[model samples]
Target: MTWKDKLGLVHIYTGNGKGKTTAAFGLAVRMLGSGGKVAIVQFMKAPKAYGEQKKIEECGALIESFGLPKFVHGKPTEEDIEAAKRALARAKELASSGEWDLVIVDEVCVALGFNMLDVGEVRELIKSKAPHTELVLTGRYCPEELFELADYVTEMREIKHPYQRGVIARRGVEY
Candidate 1:
């Protein structure tokens, strides 16, 4: 309801590399293992194709996806923007409800980087989150403001990625 009621845990995973989403999902699974309620807010992807999304669904956590499908480097359309806004609203409600122990915002920084949402709005949502909530945010090129607000930050620096060799993403590995 107010900033004083907000949580203390936050993490940011960023950089031009793989495993940001995977790492966050791992944390979510770990929290679930400990009998914690969880929610995942997916940005720039859907629930249909991702392995992690499917796994979380079967595990019974609340998982929601937003953003439209676009090929790499494609610009977002207006519909995609609206979906992102809707997803943010849903995430805010969940975060403020004090229902989830862990909440992951996958690829949120990428959405902000594309100007789909404002950093201030996201910061406000984080500020309004419930006490004891753990927010995990993942994406490349995270804004410094988000980083400054984070209690922990991890950057997945790309050393060698198969994408450079034209390797398609393998299910269970990338997705």
Candidate 2:
């Protein structure tokens, strides 16, 4: 369905790529340009030194980082799971009330892949979101259930990345 035709749409941007969260942010910008309210919940990223968080504030969107720096790769701690649950609950609250037109859960797939958040719970949250709200899920290895629930799915395959080389993540480009 067209974006206009879908009041509540689920989008999955998954795979081993660099632009999953970037794609979600692009959609948030699009929705914001259309005068849609947006809220972003970052699951895997810590609040320490994220450049997008600053840019999002400049763009007039609410962003909440609900992650600790304790998790490593696909392994998460018990505290990380708790944080994910609380963050997902907060996102659901915002989505259910219809205050925002778009809600983005960034790196949620990684959280699920690491068993930090329940896939069933996330699916239910998306299914139960307000009709006027759109939800975007972004991260690598999105769950099959989430993929099935999505109205649109875009996978970004990494042919090559600068990280493969000795190139460090520079400011504004990598962060």
Candidate 3:
């Protein structure tokens, strides 16, 4: 039997702090090392020069980003909505296809908070996942209803951050 035959659970990483994606990627690396298939659907983030992208690709995991290059602050534009919808659709397909052992929806909570995707749709996606396919959702502003549905929920609380001193995101560190 393959690793996919084992039990799979829903995991949510959410908070106002950093490391949600980092934690999820860490697990992805672990799962990949065990010869499991992983698919990451990144929402609100286009492909960039992040070091993790290269490493994840090299490790044989599929990673797809759906978003414009710019950051959305106030109101998301039509393009942002379209990209988020596409990302959700891709995530749903991956979760139920039985091709991947683990599916990560990166920054999906942020997409929901931005009103780019519906919470009910996300809930339905989670419910529709294959019984053996692990599902991971990462980002800030996770809805309370989702928390109730998750088997594991971790909140990364920021006690201190370099950004408070006007430090910008560093390559291979923050990205």
Please report, in order, the local distance difference test score of every candidate based on alpha carbons.
0.83, 0.84, 0.92
lDDT tens readout by residue for model 3, 1-175: 9656774799999999989999999999999988898999999887864789878988989999997898898999998999999999999999999888899999999999998988999999899898899999999999999988899999999999988999999988988
Best candidate, lDDT: 3
Flag regions of model 2 displaced more than 4 Å. 1-6
Candidate with best TM-score: 3
Candidates in order, TM-scores: namely: 0.91, 0.91, 0.96
Candidate 1: where are CA atoms >4 Å away?
A: 1-7
Q: Which 10-residue span in candidate 3 carries the lowest summed lDDT?
A: 1-10
Positional deviation of 91 in candidate 2, in angstroms?
Answer: 1.3
State model 3's lDDT. Answer: 0.92
Separate clash counts for every candidate:
0, 0, 0
Clashing residue pairs in candidate 1 are none
